[model samples]
Every structure is written in C-alpha cells, then in structure tokens.
Target: MGVCFSTIKVSGSNSNNNVNHNRKEATKQQTKTTKATAPTRKKQEVVDHQQNNKNVNNEEEKKLKVKEKQGSKAIPCGKRTDFGYDKDFGMRYTIGKLLGHGQFGYTYVATDKANGDRVAVKRIEKNKMILPIAVEDVKREVKILRELTGHENVVQFYNALEDDSYVYIVMELCEGGELLDRILSKKDSRYTEKDAAVVVRQMLKVAAQCHLHGLVHRDMKPENFLFKSTKEDTPLKATDFGLSDFIKPGRKFQDIVGSAYYVAPEVLKRKSGPESDVWSIGVITYILLCGRRPFWDKTEDGIFKEVLKNKPDFRRKPWPTISTSARDFVNKLLVKDPRARLTAAQALSHPWVREGGSASEIPIDISVLSNMRQFVKYSRLKQFALRALASTINEEELADLKDQFDAIDVDKNGAISLEEMRQVVFSLSNL
Candidate 1:
C-alpha cells in the first residue's frame, strides 16, 4: 500500500543510478500480492491457524463506546462539491490533503469537525471494483482493521461507511508520515544497530498482535508502517490492510501479494503463513541498519529471484559495525524455510531485540570490514578456492570468514556457483 521507495546501492557499486532507475520503474508497476493468486499456484490443505484464537473485539467495543460518548457520528455533508468531498461525511470529518493511494484506494487526511481532531480517510471507489475479488479484498481489509482496532501498534479504525460512489475508512492520522520517511530523515542518515533493534522490536510486536488475532499482513513493507507523531520514539503503527487476510495459524496462504523486496521466499513458492511477515521484518531490519537492501537487483523480477534464493550479505561494510547478536537475529528470520523462521513473538524475545539500545555500544569489527573489501574483488574461481581453503582453517579463529563464505554459497551445495560469484562480480563491474 502507498508503494514508494528510494533506491539503495548494492554491494561494490560506486553509483546509485541503477538503483534509482529501478526504483522508478518499480513504482510504476508495484506488485499487489496477486502473484500467488495466479491460476498455476497450488493450494495446500492445512488446519486453520485461527482455531485456537478468539476474536479480540472487546477492545474494539470499548473504543467504540468511547467514540460514541464523544458524539463523533458520521454526518452527511449534503451534495458532493470540492472535487468529490461530500460537503461533510457523517457530518463529522472535513477532508483535507490527499495523502496517498494504495492498491485498492486513496487515503486522505481529514479534520474532525466536532473537536478539530485529525484523522485519515481511505476512500475506495466503488466503480473501480469490477471484479468480485476486488470487492472481497476491500471487505477483508475492513474486517481485519475492525478486529485489531484498539491495538497500540495498529492504526485505530474509527468507522467504515459506504456511499453510492465510495467506501470510506476513517482512522487516526499518522502526522509524522511513513516509517520510511522517518528512517530516511534520521540526522545521521542511518540507524545504529541498537536503533534498528528498537524499530524491529516494534514491528515484531505489531506482527505478533496481528498473528494472534488470526490476521496475516500480506504486505508488511516499511511503507505500511507509520509514526503517530514527530517524536523520535513515537510508536510505530502498522497500516494498509488492503492485501492482508485472516490467515489461521497452520493454514497456508497462496496469494502472493506484497512489495517485491519484502515478499518472503515461501510467498514466491506459493505457500505462506504468518512467518512470511517475519521474513519481511528481517528485510526491514537489514535496511534499517545499513541504508541498503540485503537482496537487490536492477529489476523487480531480479529482486524476486534474489529474495527467493540469495542469502543476505552480512559481511558487507555497515554490517561489520553491527553486533554479532544482531546478525544472528537477522539470520534466523531470513531463513529460507518458513517453518524454521523465528515467529514474531520469538523475534521480540531475541537477544538483539531484548538488548535494545545497549547493543549500540558494542565495538565494531574493523578487520572484518577490511576482509570484506578484499573479498568483494575476488574472482569466481578464487571465491570457490577460498571457501574450500576456509574449511581447512580453525573454525573459531576465522569464524566470520567461514560464515561469509557459507552465505555466498546460499544454496548450501558446498560449492559456490558462477551465478553466485557473478552477484559480487557484477557489482564490482558496475563500479
């Protein structure tokens, strides 16, 4: 939802022009989680993940009572004027700025007339819903938002109303804007490992809440996360459920809907569950610390291929500044096997996450960075020979190198393929 992102230069590249060009192209043709909906995708039969979970509407009901006490009812503003704004929707909100558009609709910032409170109104045009699938997608989004209404890490859903032309979804406005913007705006231009831990912890909490409520946020990109205000530590709330679904725990989801960079390996394989969201969080964590993507290419299809196969390069520059515990956490989440990936709750409890801001004080590994610089320039034959040589070295003394070698051998075939070596070679040639 609200798909937009700046380009991130890949390893060994001296220019970000290719990244910027690809980002522009990707913005024009954003993937909307329908890849899994293809006819050839196979459906798997598994027990529902929600059978053991109860709906959390008690919080929603309490919030509703509070809103009612404030007399915040949607009032008709009479005739449509001002470029489609109902003079007054439910007689309460006066639409303001056009925030952004998602896969199924547009979102606007609106003013609450009664007390001047700001809110976001997502408008889904009825005429655009020519397919039954599109209509159901809208309904499912509304349902998931209503179910997770009062969760602190979720954007609160105030009301959902339908008119002849559009379906309006009103909720709290995130004035600080997208989490991506906030991350980009950081004074230092990048988050420290500790700072990234805080962000990832918040993301996991939201994911944990959503999963517990039997919902899977099919699209968990940074664009879907928003800061409530301008405060540095403002709570991050997950938004835009357009591609989300009520996925039960054990049941698999075949719909391949999500941004290319953050989509999980299983989602590409046409079988996914809540763990898919965790994989996305891992990608976010990787970007948060390094100001680059772990898996990136010049095209969306290339990016998808990398996500489905390539292992994250934890031996890259900025990564040496990150803590061992932090790398360990990311490794666990980015696991190719969804079942082996850390659950949201488990990620929240990770040593890196639990350590929080304290992890920033850990000393950087200067030697590792020097080693990476040399490693990046290695030839395909040399890379393979080095890996073979690494196996003969004392594992404890050269543990980091051993791990780096293994990461490049992503397929775990015990030998690095020319295709794998080309990933680094191509980046170097681009320089």
Candidate 2:
C-alpha cells in the first residue's frame, strides 16, 4: 500500500494531509441464508445443473474451472519450468512499461503477444533477499492473497508463478488512479457522504468476504484501495494483499504487520486476527470522510506508537460537522480488543454503510459468492463428499459442526441451528 502518496494535486478531490475527526466523532452506522449462496444472493436462486450445458465445454464452465498455476495437469509442480511458467502455457508476452513499485513488489504493464492482450503483472521479491526480518512480512502477504477468494471487494489473482528471480502474480489491470494521489493533490476534496458510505461499504463488503475465508487483510487504507472513477468499465479491484494472513480456527497471528497510519492496536503486540483488519477499516473510514489519515506524524516509530496509544480528539477534526452513525461505526472497529470488534459482515449492516447502498454497495452489483473459481476450488469433489456425508448424519453427525463452534452449549441447550451457521458463514465470507 502506498501511504506516501504523490501531492501533484487533482480536480474534484478530498482535502488535507490528515483527518481531524476523533473516534468519538464517529457515532453510528450500524448476513446469510440457507443453501449455498451465490456471492450476490439478494434472494433465492438454484443452480440448475441439468438445465444448463453441464456436458459440453462452455465458456462459463471454462471460467468456473479454476486453472491454478500449480494445479494444471500439464503444469504440475515437477513439470513446471524453473520460473514455474508452464511450458504448455509458455511466456508468450513481452514485458511492457514498469507501472510502479510498492513496498515489496513492482507492477508492470505487459503485452501478451499470443492474444494481443494487455495485462498487469506483479513481481514479488523473496523477503530473505533483503533481510531476515522481511521474511515474515513476505509470507504474511503471499499467504493471505493465495488463501482468499470469492469477494468482489478484494483484489483478484489470475495466476501465481514461482521463478528463480521472483514470484509473479498476474491480475486485472486497474487504470482509474490511486486514491492517495487524489487525496494529496486536492485542497478542498470532500468526498460526499454518499460516496464515502459506498466506498466504505464496498470495502467492508470485501473485508467481510475475507473474514469468511479465514484470512485477515491486516492492511486496510485508501492507499491499499484502488479507485477508477475515470473509466466506465470496472470501478477497481482492491490491490495489495501482501500484508494478509489466514488465521486458523481458534487461532490468531502474532506478527505486527501493516502500515502505521492504519495499524490496529492488537497488531502492535504482534497478536491479532479479523479484528486487526477491522481496525484498518476504521482508519480508512476516517480518511474517506475527513480526507486525511486519522493519525499523522513525521516519525514511523511515533506513528506506530500513536496507533497503539492515543485516540483522535473529535474537537480537533477540521470538518464543521459529521454524522452520528459514521462516528458510531468507527468506534466499533477501533475497539482495542479483537473479540470486541464488529465482524466485517456486521459492519456492512451498519447504517453508515447502508445509507448510500445504491451508489456504493450495489453500484457494480458484484457478488463474489458466485465466483466460478470459488465453486471450482472450494466446492470441489471433496466438499461435495463432505456435504454428502453430512446429509447421512444420525445424531452423531451434528457433533462435528457443533464442535467447530464451541459457542453452542455442550448439551445443545442453545438452539443454534444451521440457519445461524449459514449466517456466520456469510458474515465471515470475506476471510
């Protein structure tokens, strides 16, 4: 994520170097279903496998078939080239201009000579190449990106390749422009409440997806978010999943990773999980409304400390006035305890996020739930088998899922049913 954005200035943008709103200033804001849901399930719909062309190789079927760079029968681990590019799918593209460099990677625009298509290529250097300390950082990022899927709000990956030189990830190219550049350049850039709500809600939508996948995008900020107001194609794909991590069941991460301005408190002590991402969401929320970071300072160490220690003084906020729901939503995510924080899905339900649902959440009408890649990978042969076995359960079969959630009474006192389970699944779907 590029926190240090260029200050060249732009027309019709947000104002300032930092936001003046305090945590107290954000007062308010305030999912799921039975059956497997399409990412954008507003109501009910069934997959008519037999009614559709399930026999022939259709275009939609092909897209649904996830061609993992690692899973292709022709591109198995052993057969893959030294750079891991499949010989069957050789490098038929010429590398184009260097787009830009981030903390650990460089992006380039490339031309695929094979199809005459243009694509964005991200190259990641091994962390150990620089220093031992950077290893964890690199792993945190790669692991999270690879683990997450099926979310319209998060970044999408076309492929991951391992070469002697570096790890190359191919992704959709976003040309709109970085929010940071606009934020820095505009003298009076005030994102309207509707725009702010939509952006935050969309972000939370992605964040919610991450939580469901058991991963944490530890870094959340405007810089990490890519916006494309210029183009009429796609708005933007969330960029930079390097600081992400998959927190296992009944577990959390102990690495303090992410940008200082958006770091969550639990992150400072190297112990965090879904809540850490929520904290970053809060920081981004502050920036979108106030047109500046919630916390700002000169020194990196000082900024880190501020994230850990101080709270924003609402009186210091530059805005003449702010909404009550907005303040409430920020407070929910900024909570110090990980467990106390609102889940991303819940955040979406907040009034601040839903107030402008038309402009923000539903504008693009994206729903990662229906992602073909997800159904191909996650709803694979194994999942089919598991669900099949689950159907055959007597009294004992209920124990497995119940055991997964110890929240229910051991004696089954609490009537937490599959309905509740499905709700939780959607709430944490972004994970």
Candidate 3:
C-alpha cells in the first residue's frame, strides 16, 4: 500500500490550477523512491500512491516543478462542462487531497465540480512513464479496467483521459478503506466465519468475472479489496489493475508478481494461471478466520520458503474452532499443487461459501480462545514456526501439543527462554 495523502481543501481560486496540478504530479513522482519492497523481490510492480495529498509550499513547488512540463490548459468548470472535465482534466477536477500514489501516478479524491460527485482520479504523469514496459503496464491496466466495466465486485472505471503531461483515470470512489484495515482494526482482530464467507464470495466473484473476461489479476490481496461505501454490508470491490493482464485459455503466466503473503505456490515456481488467484483467496480466508497469517515469517525468504513447502495451519487454535466446511474450503484452495486447488467457480460452490460459513451470531470455541491467549505470548519466530507446524499436524495428534513441538523446531533451536515462559504463564493467568 502507498502512503495516504491527507485530505486538503482545494476550494481556492482556480487561477493556479495548472501549477497546482503540475506540483502534485512532481511530488507524486518524487515520492516514488519511498515505495516499500520485499528485500528479495526488489522488482515488484510499481504500486500507486497512498490516499490524501498535502499541498506543496511555494518554495518546494519552485524547486520541484516539472522541468520539461508542457500543457497548462485550464479546464472549463460548471454544469455544462464535458465529461471528465472537458479536455484539460485539471480544470474539471479540483484535486482536493492526494488519495494515494504509485510508480506510474498519484490517486486523488477529486471533486467533480460539474456533477458534485466525488471521484478518484489517478494521475499517471507521462513524464515519468519513461520505459516502454512501464507505459504498456499502464495501458494494460486501463484496458482491463475498461473491459471489466459494470462488474459488481470490481472497481468501476468511469473514464481515462490524457493530456500532454498526464493520463487522468476517473474511477468510482471507495470510501470505506481497504479490507485489510477493516480486519486488523477489529478489537479481536478477526471476522466471523460467516463474514469471511461473504468477503471471500465477493472476491471470488470478481476473480470469476476477470477470468471470464480473459483477464488475470496477478496481484490479489486484502489491500486491493476496498469497500464500495461506508455501509455495513457494502460490497468489497477489487481495485488496482496495474499488475493485471489478458490471458488466453490454456495460457500460463510466468511473472512472479504479487504481495508475498497471498502469492500462490505456482507463482513461486514461475508458472501461474487463474488458479493462482484462488490460492490467494485461500490465504485471505485464513486471515479472515484468524487474525494471524498462515505461513508468516519475519523475512520474505522465510515466508516464501513456507509458501513453497508448508501447508496452512488448520490444526491451530482458530482452526480448531472454525467449522469443518470452512476448513475444507480453505484446504481445497491452498493445495500445494495448482491443479489440485479449487477454481474460483468451484470454490464459490463449496458448502461453506454456499451456506455462508457459520451463522453470524455463532460463538467462537473455547479452544480457540485458549490458544489465542497462549499464541500471542510466543516470540514472533516461535509463533511463526508453531503456526506452520499446526497446519501439518494430523487429527490423531490433536491432544498432545508437546508431540508437535519437536517437529516444528526445524532448526533445532529448541531452548525456550525462562522470560518467555514467564510471559506465557502471566498471560495464561490473565486469560
């Protein structure tokens, strides 16, 4: 995720609109170097900027103004203005605050003066689109979004307009923030199985729609899932088609792109298809059910190592409480073999999804409560290994937690510190 620019009022005189737009374009590009990347996967997709834009001061503006800037056409405002604010996008959209930015451009929550509707405008500065591949990626993103218009679970692409300095993309505003933020913000840090089912169903619906339209969203993660509105049951719409591409039937993509936590095993192996997105949904399902990541590790390498070799932790505290159908659903999609994994349509038809997991009012299990109490006491590394071990444990060995400890001590670093034990004991007493 990119930095979210704080909302600033742009209700000033329209005299400096072109200068302000250019300043924003330059600020967004300068901030590109700040994008976070995996240590091992240095070449990940150039993500867009975060929400909200800060107004640049005059001195900074002078220093940062685009050197070879050309267009400064003023947009005609008022009710009769053409769509997307006539030809000059700056005139129509008074960029209020920077919403977010990416390698290609910045996203702003712009006000459409003519309609009074809030629209998210992604500004892809032509000056920064230096390489052919980068330019093509932007084109592909626009093309995919255009083709997938009117999808219920995908972001609505209203218009894509370009001037000499920037390509402006107007899209439906998702006011509810990322699905990841929603999950993590919960007090218990978890969604009910029924809620998970609803979320996963929406995600799968988008995935199915994309596949049906001959496209593949190479990157599918919680951050990409945004709520359509602030309503309680507002649909989660998938956004960010930067890493997406058109795929013909039977074609396999070899690009290893995607956020580490939700990437599929086949992607790590350099072969991926629509099933890869299914695998990501499985990861999201696990997180939705439990607050924790299934194959988490401190480092990207450690995470990838687990993704390549480890099964998701189904025997862990939360899993023990999770319904059997829910477990089966996740297990089907997280299969190590892509061929064995469930497709989006198939996963959508799973019993748990069909029934909407456990009912919303259902209570979580005591075992899950107890395990979560003890689980949080462990060091990050130990917790990581324990979760990984939990997935591999069979039902027959459920009673003896100790029996699985040695198996999880993969590096033979077996000593549990007295301080750690004391912390666990103290946590248990409080529980």
Native-structure RMSD, model 1 = 31.8
Which of the two candidates, 1 or 2, achieves a greater lDDT against the reference? 1
- Alpha-carbon shift of residue 388 in model 3 (angstroms): 32
lDDT of 1 by residue, 323-361 (tens): 778788889999999878889998888888874334575
- Ranking by lDDT, best first? 1, 3, 2
Model 3 lDDT tens row, 126-220: 64543345566777788898998898888899887777667788999998888855544456634466766888899999999988988889789
Full ranking by TM-score: 3, 1, 2
Model 2 over residues 1-431: C-alpha lDDT tens digits? 02213331332255343222221232221012322354445332334444355555576666657654214432322223244343322365566799777545688987676778777788765522333334445545555666654456556566666555466677666666665444333344333556567667777877877878887777776666776445423454577876666778878676556766788888777567787777888877766555455666777678877777787645544433566666777778777777888988888888777754432222111121122223234324754676577558743344345445545433332234445677677768968
Q: Is candidate 2 or candidate 3 better by lDDT?
A: 3
Q: lDDT of all the models against the reference?
A: 0.72, 0.59, 0.71
| Best of the two (2, 3) by TM-score | 3
Sliding window of 10 residues with minimal summed lDDT for model 2? 361-370
Per-candidate Cα RMSD to the true structure, in Å, reads 31.8, 37.4, 28.8
Query: Where does candidate 3 stray beyond 4 Å?
Result: 1-86, 184-191, 355-360, 365-431
